[model samples]
Target: MVDKFPAEQQRIVKGLQDAVDRLNTIARGVAPIKVNKASEYFDLPEASPAAPGSGVRLYSGGGKFTVKTSANKTVTIPMADVANPANFTSPSTQTGDFASASAYTQLRADCARLHDTVRDLQNAMRAAGLMG
Candidate 1:
């Protein structure tokens, strides 16, 4: 039998999505993106204008927080995260022509792979006899 850990986990997730499919449109997210997770704040590369702990979640590239298992979630950022300074530029964390081009590409590819893996996992889990 194929591995049940990851597969079953994904099936459960897919089942959740399938169930949500019957919900009203209003319960869904906007057209572009539909998510209610707190970590969604980092969806953008931009920094938040609001001060720290403003009782709001933002896309600022600072601070570290736990996510899921917190495996690759232990993150640390420099103060240069958001520079409202007159001379604002993509910080070192940014992967532009200035930064390591190859590293940027590799990271991009890795993210894509991870997304697909999780997606497949979720799909597999929903396939009867895989998880449930």
Candidate 2:
């Protein structure tokens, strides 16, 4: 139990919890993706206040969704997933440097797996009629 931790450690944990809660709140308001004008059916973020000019833009003639970050990094999401947002595999990036190239690559793969898990959860929710 948290009660076993020293008072100082408990305070630190509480601080981290507060920080996570704040981040979650910010994530909730993130702008949705904007699909390219040429794309007949796709949705991507219009802007990401978090990434500033790195707002997501759609491309691939509605077959792909691309997002460019200020750091010149690009992320692509499948058009099918964009059309069915519930199935989108939202990627995550680790903040720190990796110990080796292999480590980095594995981490990236793990992140993809996490996204797949998210899609699975979404499917379960929809099957239960929890989502429309």
Per-candidate Cα lDDT values, in order, are 0.48, 0.57
lDDT of 1 by residue, 29-119 (tens): 5565556556534444444343333243434354432122123222222222222223223243653464576666666666666676666
| Clashing residue pair totals per candidate (backbone < 3 A) | 4, 5
Which stretches of model 1 miss by more than 4 angstroms?
1-98, 129-132
TM-score of each: 0.23, 0.25
Most accurate candidate by lDDT: 2
Worst 10 residues of 2 by lDDT: 79-88
How many residue-pair clashes does candidate 1 contain? Answer: 4
Question: Cα RMSD to native, each candidate?
Answer: 25.1, 27.5
- Per-residue lDDT, model 2, residue 107, is 65
lDDT of 2 by residue, 53-97 (tens): 655433343344455556655455432231222332323454455
lDDT (0-100) at residue 77 of candidate 1? 29
